[model samples]
Target: MIGETLSEDVLSQLKTILPKYGLEDTELKIIQSYRDSSQLNQQSGFSFQNEAGSKIQEEKIHLLENELRILKDKDHLAQSVAKEINVLFPSVDSFSLGDFLVQNVQDFSSSKEVTVLVKWKHQVGSVERKRLELF
Candidate 1:
């Protein structure tokens, strides 16, 4: 049956005899593989449903991964900006990031450009200074 050719007679005989070969007699020795195949078919149906469910969930995972990457990139940019400011004013004692804002505007190139505006605050001694940085 596997890669080997079968004669029509063998095929017909197999179809005819397979079901009747093991009748439940006084001895309970019946073909177990036949019942196993039936159970496997039922289980395959259940797994098919799960497979379809996983397809939808896979898209959800993709979207969440993209959102996570964008957040990480934004955070990295913010950290770099803060580090630069810290280097410029080493005496600055405290730094707090307040809000992140995005805007669309035209630059010197006369094309639409996306601008990321970060609102932050730093304290020197008791004086707190707030500023907005853009990139």
Candidate 2:
């Protein structure tokens, strides 16, 4: 498992097991980081379904952000734990899922009102369409 990377779905489910290993605080921190990252991501052009998904996204971003911060610290134990986290959630280092939130952006010239268009892409038959939009 250390040589091969973990998939997103697997990482998501495996995250639950970290707590059993007494890494709950570390995991929570990572979730908080992802939440913070998600807030910035919300500024991007995309939409979320219901408040629950939005809330969950925020929490995940926050957790990821906190974990990154803690990992950056010089604590030896924290560093070791961070390595374990990397092994579990391989996607975290690959791309910021938060970036998916802000793939597109539009601005109004007169009002100076920044409209954030959030859309979720879905597959319809043979084509993919953005089904949800939010500003």
Candidate 3:
């Protein structure tokens, strides 16, 4: 959830999304202003029914539109990323690397086992063997 303070990157992304969705810079500014105003109103316990508050409320609608647009873009991006990962390592029924590796009987009985053991030793160093008396 976008808390009281949104990041600069999020605002910049909004700027890019606004134009793509036919929104102007001024429109985005107005939307951001409303967001700020609403935060202030929440703190003050005031009804957003005054003239200025009405404008802010209207801008809130635009902000929701912008949020929805961004979410849709993100959803599409997630799908595309999934497809790319699938294509890169196809022939696996599922996406999990751990599950796939464990299920597949790719020969790891000799050289692969040695390679893994060496890599693990390199990672842990001699300290584990010395401490655990794993001679």
Candidate 4:
């Protein structure tokens, strides 16, 4: 039972759950170790879908989903900022706002005063940093 493999159904359920938890390939190996040690496949009527119905798991899933939504919102904001920068700095040939990495962000007492330190590579293989202000 210990060395036995999980059925396709269980494996499929695991694949769905693992990604929702942000588990990567390395973490999957740890899960495999636990699965092998626990011999979950040998248990009668053991279902990951059923286990996922637990309150704690549901709460964790909800939290992770919220985090993902926030991250997506931030990414959209970044893209919008990039587009705006591209329009504003049209004179800089070969300059892509998306290529700029955010080094630092500072906010002043006034909402209009926002400063961002961005770093990007120049066409001549040099890194350049610029402090941009938003008013």
Candidate 5:
């Protein structure tokens, strides 16, 4: 059952059980939201004709809009990071890029320089690590 507040005990139980089903926190949140919204819709059937129901509908719309904005911002950020990574390693193919893992980021605020530690696996099964600087 969904409650007004998601308790620590519920979260702990979810954390333990979800992994066995190959579901992560984000996926669980989406599923929970969908189920909650479905329940709300059922409970409010035809009630939208009233003022109170209209206010609740407006609030839900606002909440959904905010979530959409956050998702868009995250998408833009991911694209920007991918562009930076491509610029940092032009020779690295798309498939090889998958093998690259970011180890650390060092930023020099005064100089406007950023250093990233990247570890990559080569086609020959050897691992290579590099420190790249961007200005």
Candidate 6:
């Protein structure tokens, strides 16, 4: 489901969930708040009656879980174009632009394997260097 878009139905449904912990809002107002945007983007925001806030929180958790799963899968493999680029590249000085790669499939042993041709640009002080790694 990578890159999958949330359906409008899911969005609308998410827009309607009340904070389970806002139990102090009196059961009546809290219940009514469901399917109601009357409380969002207002002073009564979150911690109480915000709808979008809850959905966003849930979506963030979902994305993090997916990322962890992808990382685990990567660990189970030997070679991959998937690098830990997001882990902050160790640049020497002020700026570093790196880990650019073109994806391709290479046929090996009658099977196709994913290959990457990576180009990295590193800059230290006024000196800039470019390196390529193919695997």
The top-ranked prediction according to lDDT is 5
**What ordering of candidates by TM-score runs from best to worst?**
1, 4, 5, 3, 6, 2
The lDDT of each candidate is 0.53, 0.47, 0.52, 0.52, 0.54, 0.45
Candidate 6 local lDDT, 40-103, one digit each (tens):
4353454553689889999999999998887677555523323443233344222223323444
* TM-score computed on alpha carbons, candidate 1: 0.38
Q: Which candidate is the best by TM-score?
A: 1
Candidate 3 lDDT, 97-123, residue by residue in tens? 111123335764432111111112134
lDDT of 4 by residue, 52-115 (tens): 4687788999999998997677678777877776676543333222223334446432232223
For model 2 the local lDDT of residue 28 reads 32
Give the runs in model 6 whose Cα sits over 4 Å from its true position. 1-49, 79-135
What TM-score would each prediction reach against the true structure? 0.38, 0.21, 0.30, 0.36, 0.35, 0.27
Residues 1-135, candidate 1, lDDT per residue (tens digit)? 113455567666666665587642423322323244456446444333467799899999999999899778868876886788677655554455434344446553343344443333443333333332221
TM-score of 4: 0.36
Those runs of model 1 whose alpha carbons end farther than 4 Å from true positions after fitting are 1-52, 98-135
Kindly provide the TM-score of model 3 when superposed on the true structure, using C-alpha atoms: 0.30
Q: Give me the displacement of residue 19 in model 3, in angstroms.
A: 61
Location of the lowest summed lDDT over 10 successive residues in candidate 4:
126-135
Backbone clashes in model 3: 0
Pairs that collide, model 6: none
